[model samples]
Target: MTGHSAVGWVDIVVILGYLLTTVYLGWLGYQRTRTGADYLVGGRSVHPIIMAVSYGATFISTAAIVGFGGVAGLFGMSLLWLTFLNIGVGILLAFTLLGEPTRRLGHHLGAHTFPELLGARYQSKGIQIFAGLLIFVFMPLYSAAVMTGGAVFAATQFDVDFEVALLVFALITAAYVIPGGLKAVMYTDTFQGLIMILAMAYLLLFAYTSLGGVSAAHQYLTGMADLVPAPLQAMGHQGWTAMPKFGWGATGYDLWWTVITAIILGVGIGVVAQPQLVVRFMTVRSRRELDRAVPIGAVFILFMTGTPFAVGSLSNAWFAQHGPLLKGQVVKEIDAERGHALVGLMKETSPGRWEPVINPKTNQPATAPMVVVAHQPAQDGQGAPVDLVSGRAPTVVYAKGDADQIIPTFINTALPRWFGLVFFLALLAAAMSTMSSQFHTIGTAAGRDLYERITGKHGTEPSVLAMRIAIVIGLLVSVSISYNVREEYVIARFTAIFFGLCAATFLPAYVGGLFWRRATRVGALASMTVGMLVSLFWLLLVKAKEASAIGLVQLVTGGKTSLLADYPNWPSVDPIIIALPLAMLTLILVSAVTKPSDPQHLRRCFPQYAAPQATTL
Candidate 1:
C-alpha cells in the first residue's frame, strides 16, 4: 500500500495482448460475413449460444461494473437484490415468455431491425419511421453514458488523459465493429465474457483471503465500529455485515424504494424494450435454439452482476488500512466506519502480511505501529473513537458520500500490478464489445427501415456503405455528448427512462397488431406520439429538482436551480412510470373507438404469442 507499483511493462503487455486478440477476432468475423444479410444479422446462422453471449454482454456493460458496483459500495449489500431481479425478471421471464414469440414473429416477417418488424406486421410505414427515429435518438444517449464510464475509469487507473482515453476507446471500438459487423461483435463479446468471469472470481477470493477470511474481517470491523467517536457517529455509520441504522432503517427505505423500483423494473422490463438487443433475436434459427441458449445467458448475467455486488459490499473494509486520504472534506468525506472499513479489511487479509519495517529516516520502525496507531479505541453510545474521530471505536463499515470513483480506486490500490492490468483489459473489453453491438443495432435500424423499405428495393451497395458511415456519425455524436456535455444523468437512470417509453409505446401496439385484432394504424401512431411526448415533458419538468422545487413560475422564468444547485438538470417521472400507462390507454381506447387491425392479418402476425402464456404477471 505504501509504495505501490505504478503500472509497468507487464501491464502494458497485458493490454496490448487483449487489443490484438480482439482486432484479430473481428477480422475473422468479417471473413465469414459475405452478404448484407450475413453482415447485418450474422447470416441468421449465429449459434444460439453465441447470440446469448452477445445479448448478455450488451446488458452487462461498464455501467454495471464501474457505476452500479460503486453504488453498491456506498449503499451496502442490500443492493445485491438486483442480482435476483436480473436473473428472475430480466432473464427468466424475458426468455421464457418473450423470446420465442419475438423470434417467431421476426422470422415470419423476415425482419432485420425492430422498426422493420413493426412496419411489416401492421403494414404501416409510419410505425416503421417512428420506431427508426426513436432508435436514432435515444440509443446514442445510452452509448454516450457507457463511453463516459469507460473513459473516467481508464483515466483514474492508467494515468491516461481522460478525453484521450475516451477518444481511443471510440476509435479502436469502431475499427473492429464497422469492418466485421454483428458477427465480429458477438465473437468478441463471447471472449470478453470469459475473461470477465475469471477476473472477478480471482478478485473475490483475493479480497476475502487478504482480510483474514470472513470471520476475522468481521470481528475487526465490529471492533472498529465500537470505537467511532461521537458527533461523527451520530450520522449514519455501521459495519459491513450489519444493516445501517441511520433512522432510515436497514436499507434507507425511501431511497431504496426509488432505486429498486427504477432498476428492477428498469432492467426487468427494460430488457424487452431495448431495440438493439431485441434485433438479435431475429438471427436465431428456431425456438429450439432460443431454448438452448436460455441457460447460458442466465448464468452469465448472474455471475457478472453477483460478483461486482459482492466486491462493492466489502470495499469499505478494503480501503481503510490501505489508503485513508478522506480529501479533507467538511462532511468527513466518508462516515467513520464506512471510510475505514475497506483498508482495515485489507490490513487483516493481505498475503504479504503487513509489517512495520523501519523507515530508514526514523529507523526503529518509523513513528509507530501501522495497525495499532490506526487501531482507534472502542466507542460509546454516540460512537466516538479517541484516535480516529471521537473517543469511541468506529463502525465496521463506512460510506464515502460521493460515489464516482471509489471502486476503481481500491482495485488499482489492492491488486498486484499484473492483476490490475488484466482488470483494465477486461473493462476495456466490456466497453468495446457492448459498443459494437450498439453500433450494429443502430446501423440496422437505418439500413433496413429507412433505406431499404422506403425505396421498395434496397439502396445499392453505396446505401450499405452509408449504413457503415452512419455508425461513425452515431459514434461521433455520442462521443461529443460524452465529452462536452455535463448532464445530471446515470447510465441506468436514462436506460430505465427510455425503456419505459419504448414499452408503453411499442409493447401494446406490437401485441395488438399481431394478436388482439383491436389495434389500428391510427391508434398505434397515437400511442407512439403520446408516449414519446409525455416522456420528454416529464423529464424536462418534473424530474429536475429546481423545476419541481420552485414550481411553474421558476420553470418558465429562466430556472435558477441549474447554476445554484449545479444539478445540470434532470427530466421527470422516469418516463416509464407515467408515459407508458398513458401510451397503453391511448392504444387500447383508440382501438376500441375506431377500427381494429384486420383479423386475418393479426393471425398471420402472431400465431404463437396469441396462443397465450400459461399465467399472467
Candidate 2:
C-alpha cells in the first residue's frame, strides 16, 4: 500500500501493442467498409461468434466490472441474479424473440440504423427522427459514465491525471471508431471481448485462490457477519451468501424495494431494449447466425457478469482481513468531503445512544481524518444511526467509504503487478469497446436517423462524413459530462437510468412493431413520448441521487422524497417498473382504439406472410 504502485515497462509495451493492434483492425475495417451500410451494420456479415462477443462486450462495460461490481461488494451476492437475467432476457429472449425479425425487416427495408429500422417499421419519420434525437441527447450521459469508470481505473493504475487518462481514452477510441465505424468497432470488440474473458477468468481464479477457495471465502464472509456494517445490517444485508429477504426482514422493505425494483428488475428487464445491444441483432447475416450466437453470448455474459459479483463480494473479505490495503484507494471527492477527524471519547453520559464524534483532547470536532459518511434511514434500538452515531463501531477508517472503489482498490492492492496490468488492459478494452459502440450508435442515430431524416436527403459518402463529425461531437459531449460527475455509484446509476429509459421508451413499440400488425403510428408515438417523459420525471424528481443533484424535488417539497409520498417505498421503485407498463398500456389502448396500420405496410414489414410461395401463381 504505497502512494502509487509503479507499472512495469513491459506492461506499458503490452498496452501500446494492444492499441496499435486496435488501430490496425480499424484500418482493416475502413478498407472493407465502402458504403454507409457496411459502416453501420458490417454489411450484415458479422460472424455469429464475433457478433455475440461484441454484443456482450458492449453490454457489460467497465460500468459493469467496476461500478456495479463495487455495488456487489456493498450489496453482496444478490447481484448474481442480474447475471442470470442477463442471459435469460438480454441474450436468449432478445435474440430468439427480436433478433431474427429485426434483421429480416431491417435488411428488407434497407434500414441501416436502429431508429431507421423503427421508422421504416412504423413508416413514421417522426418516430425515426425523434428516436435519433433521444439517442443524441441521453446517450451521452451513459457514454460519460462509461468514460468516468475507465478514466478512474486508468488514472489510479497508471498514476496519471484523470483528464490525461480520459483524453488518451477518447483519442484511442475515436481513432478507430470514427473512421472504421461498426465493422471496426466489432473487430476490436471481438478482440477486446477475448481479452476481457481471459482477464476475468484469471481474476476469478486469483480471487478464489487468494481466499483459500470459493467455499472458504463464503465461509469466512459468513463467519464475519458481525463485521457487516451496522447500517447495512439494518438494511437487511445477510452477509455474502443469501438474498435479502423480500419482506418482513430485519432490514425491512427499503432494501428489498431498492434491490428488487431498481437494481434487479430495472436493469434486468431494461437490457431487452438497449439500442446498443439491440443493434447487434442487425449486425449478423441472418436469423440462423443470431440463433447461433445465443450460447456464445450466454457464456460470455455468465463469465463477465458472474465473476465480477463473486470477486467483488469476496474482496470485502480480503479488505476486512487486510485493513492496511484500504489506504491505497483513490479517495473520491465525495468521500473526502465527508471525512472528519473527530473520535469522541465517550464517558457513558447516556445509557444507549452517545453524542456525535468530538475530540476530547481539544473539546471540539477534529478535522484530520476527514470522516465522510452516510447513514441508512434506520434507527437502532437506542434510536441512533446504527454505528455511525457511535456505539461499538470499529475505530479504523478506510481511505474512502465510497463502495465504487472496492474492485479497483482490490485489484491494485491484492493482484500481482503484471496481472493487474493485464486486468487494466482488459478493463480498458471493456470501456473502449462499449464507448466505441456508444459513439458509433450516436453517430449513426444522429447522422443517418436524425439529420438525414430532417433534410430528407441521404447518400453514403456524405452520411459517413456526417457520422464521423457526429462521433467527434459525441466524444466531446461525453468527456465534458464525465468531468462534472464525481460520485462512484452514479456511474452505475447512469447505466441503470439509460437502461430503464430505453426499456420505457422503446420496448413497447419495438415489440409491437416486430409482432403485432395492429400497432399504429399514433400508438407508437404516444408510447415513446409518455414512456420517455415519465422516466425522465421519475429519474429527475423521484430517485434520490439524480433528484438531489437536480434539486427540483427538493425545491418543490423541501425534502428529498419523491412526488409519490403516499407510498413509503415510492422513491425506491424504478422508473422502468412504472413507465414500461404504462407505455405498453398506452400502446395497446391507443393502437386498439385509433387505427391499425395499412395492410401493405404490415405485409412489407412482416415478409413471412408475403413469401415467394404466397405469390399468385
lDDT of 2 at 581: 93
TM-score for each model: 0.79, 0.87
Please identify model 2 stretches exceeding 4 Å from their true place.
Answer: 248-251, 322-400, 460-462, 611-617
Q: Write the per-residue lDDT of candidate 1 for residues 390-456, one digit (tens) a residue.
A: 3334333332233335456567656776776677776787788788888877777776666665666
Residue 488 displacement in candidate 1 (angstroms): 6.6
- Model 1 misses residue 461 by how many Å? 8.7
lDDT of 2 by residue, 67-159 (tens): 888788877888899998989999988989889988888888888788988899889999999899999999999999888888877876776
Location of the lowest summed lDDT over 10 successive residues in candidate 2: 366-375
The clash count of every prediction, one per candidate, is: 58, 8
Q: Show the colliding residue pairs in model 2.
A: 236-251, 338-371, 338-372, 339-370, 339-371, 339-372, 340-370, 340-371
The candidate scoring highest on TM-score is 2
Error of 2 at 259 (Å): 1.7
